[model samples]
Target: MRATPDNGLKIRAQLEREGINVPSLSERTPSANSKSDRKKVIMGAVIFVLENAADALKFVPIPNPDAIPNLLLKWLKVYDTVGGNDDGLKELGNDIRKAYATVLQPLELSEQIPPEVVRLIGGFHSDLEEQINEIELLKSQHLAKRTILAADITKRISGVRTCINNALNSVSTQATILTLLREIEASSQLTLERLPRAAAEHTYVKSKSACRPSTRVKIQKSLLNHLKEAKNRFVWLRGSPEIGKTAISRSIASTLEKEGTLAASFFWDKSRTGVGLDSLEWFPSTLARQLAIFNGDFKASLVKRLRRPDSELILNLLPEEQMKTLVIEPMNRLRGIFSASTQRFGIILDGLDECGDPDALKSLMNLVLLLDGLPSAFVILTWIRLHQTRLLTQSG
Candidate 1:
């Protein structure tokens, strides 16, 4: 309970002297005629308290209206001095004592509801008070509900948000699966568009592994035949340091690709001076990247898939059949722009002698060749004439 402005303080002091909790309000207060009667008694005692303060200041010099602020301070000083056990103050105290009995008369003498209940009942009072204040405005003006068009627009916005969430989730799931697929095998390469979210495509490239054929004519002819026979193939070209096998293979691949007959090609250029021996997965990845330039969604999807660490691609490299089952199967299942066109997929693997591990190279080439069911696949293996030339020649 708090003291009311000025008058209530004096009433409170008087009530306290009588061992009555004056400033506190609770359900225990006795009622007189009604609750209103009890409030009137309290207010009356408060007014009488103000009268006591007026009498206490009778001896103080009155100041001009202009000096009221200073005069009020002086009046308070005198009141404080006379506050403790003064006869006049006690008389003033008696006045409230007499008033308390009357003030408390309106409180009914029955079992009381706890004070906590009273506080809880007031929980919504602030909001009710604000609404009551706005009653005048509500009476003067009509309030309107949300318009039908506004409601419909809100519903549509919510629906669109849900749809966007669903789309993102699906794309994320696809990316996770594709990346896992990339880790497990290297038979086919996943290509993403070079835009935002570049992990949608699994990032795996076929190892450039092949035994080079002896002649450029044979390389060209073998590549052509592989293109007709398989969709994914590895062809290696072998020759001495200055041999023009790479140039010839590139010319053939580029021309065929332009004619929409070849899906991809990797020609290792000795003069160009970089990592050579491109084939299988690497070739198709380049092709897919180039193709993705025209498709933004494809680029974003590929990027998203490439970023996933748990991609299947990392796991598919164990056995040849596993590589086929995981990598090649998924590649064959891809329904994209590349498959929509009738172009054949070709890989030109150049420079077998330049590769560090020839046996591993041979295994990779063999795996690509053994990937069955892709009729339009082809690989052209290029290498320098060496001790391994007989081996390649015998295999051919």
Candidate 2:
């Protein structure tokens, strides 16, 4: 290329071609070939496009036609129109495309429009966040319910653990729980029982087994015979309070209880501070526990009855019923099982006058004697009432 002055001021570029057919300063036909040169420039651009872009269409199948850039396809079509007639233009087209892409990249926008326009992407994002918030709220509510249920389950587990620990301790503690279970079994034989009176609290009970054998000789002999003889099955004594009656009875009971021949006994004391003598309610049950403990064979029957599903209801039975159910019946059962050889028994019930109603005690006793259909079981009565005396006289 060379620069030349035109009309002394304009600068013009002139081709300096060697061995190429083009007009120059020395050539007189420059204007004559200018139209043909324009055709050559257009044809060169077509060949360059075909060389760079043609193979991209052939080697890579467009998996989604819609994914192709429309501008790229339009440009490819223009290149094919101009260069399709000449295969020599293919390489040049590919080289031009490399340069074309380098220049085009900086002009492209950041993103395409389809997801924003066709898919409602903004709504989808909002819905996702809303769903996440709802799930978090639900989790918080369920956590509270789970905590309450967990606490309840833990409480139940703790109760079971305590019960199991108590059982394990029983093995090392002399089977105290089993003894208590036996006591509970015996307790069922009684109904609304007045607490038992301690023997030491009784005035006539001087801790001796009998009234200084020298003091109550005749009384001792008679009471012993009554107890020893299982034939009579009933012995009624008539006496007054503080007249050596209770002394004899307690002496006899204390001695017999030790010998294991005493079935059951109730020493009445109105001053005893309970319903023990009130209608003799506690009489039967007190005797029952003693009898059940005395005879192992009888425990099975007593425990079986006491352990009934509704065994607590039995505690509400009348005193006479309690005596019949707990004492007389069990004694009779022993006699039945052991036959006539069943051991004779005695119950010392002294100080009847101290009862809330001595007549009630008398009536309940009379009921026992009247209903006396069992082996010999003697009762010693000591009271300070004339009415009871007449009642006893008639009943005895």
Candidate 3:
């Protein structure tokens, strides 16, 4: 039963009369003894049957539901005969069969196929048909041309898979970045909420007063000079009541703040009788909170500390322990970022003598010594009574 051009044309005409439109096969008939031509004929038959099976599913009643599975089995037999030696073609065939079985065949059997499902199947079928036509055309060409076309098709399939993988990875990376940003934001908000502060203690409080211009110039100049050139970290501004020590401290704070080196300031007024401004209970946490607001790097380091399991214990610790944990630890973490800089941060404590507790005042004097050993340069200025100032200067 050798195929001939006249036989192909007669078969096409008969099918056309039956209202079927198969591809013309007159120019594709195989030679009687050519194995390659025989393989081409088998491939064409497989493609034709697959197309008929796909078309049969389009009808509402589906001409013969049982026959469609039989057509698929026959398609696999023909595919194995021609494509078993070509791994790429064999894999493509398996994928097509799986898609049909998994998504279309079951839906068709249920008699509830949606229009979108039909469109999906139609698009998939068209793409497979185009690839099969290309393979058939390549098979008819010279061996070199067939090899080139086969390699090109393999490359295209691999590239499509790679693109899909890259898109998925990009979406995952974006989601990770967004999650990290949200966590950082939440941590920052919590840090601000947990720390206690006295709003009236800041140097910018409207009720506080700075030194009058041209007054106390000699003492102010000497203090500023010592801050700039002295190796000691602590400076004591000592005077009796009504001698303007508080005013001079306020003036120094304003100057350092304007120079962008003021880390924090706290003013204690004994006149605010019932207020806790005369105690050290909220002192360390308040300064730490202000430092966090002053610098971005310090804020990030402080947030890391707040995430620790023991962080909640910081607030309950004594003033000295709180100072070390809340303030010194975060400043130590900034060593790498601050090492190259010579700029000194100024921390002002106005009216330290006004603190009502003797034990707390002594503890604070010891804490000032601890600030001297910190990694970053810091200048601490305190205003106290002349009698109390001698104890710290003598200890230093």
Per-model TM against the reference: 0.32, 0.44, 0.52
Alpha carbon lDDT of residue 136, candidate 3?
51
- Candidate 1 lDDT, tens digit per residue, 260-378? 55433334322322332332223334433543343344444444455466444632445455444433444454446445645555544444443335665565445445544333332
| Model 3 agreement with the true structure over 57-136: per-residue lDDT tens digits | 55544334333334444434434433333434334333333333344345456566444444444444344344445545
Clashes of each: 70, 7, 0
Best by lDDT: 3
Candidate 3, residue 309: the lDDT equals 92
Candidate 1 displacement at residue 339 in angstroms: 8.8
Q: TM-score for model 2? A: 0.44
Give the better candidate number (1 or 3) by TM-score.
3
Cα error, residue 246 of model 3, in Å, equals 1.1
lDDT of 2 by residue, 203-317 (tens): 3443334467688787787777766775665555665445677777777776777776765566666664654554466656666666665677666666666556755666588
State the TM-score for model 3.
0.52
Q: How many clashes show up in model 1?
A: 70
Candidate 1: deviation at residue 72, Å?
A: 78
- Report the Cα lDDT for residue 348, model 2: 59
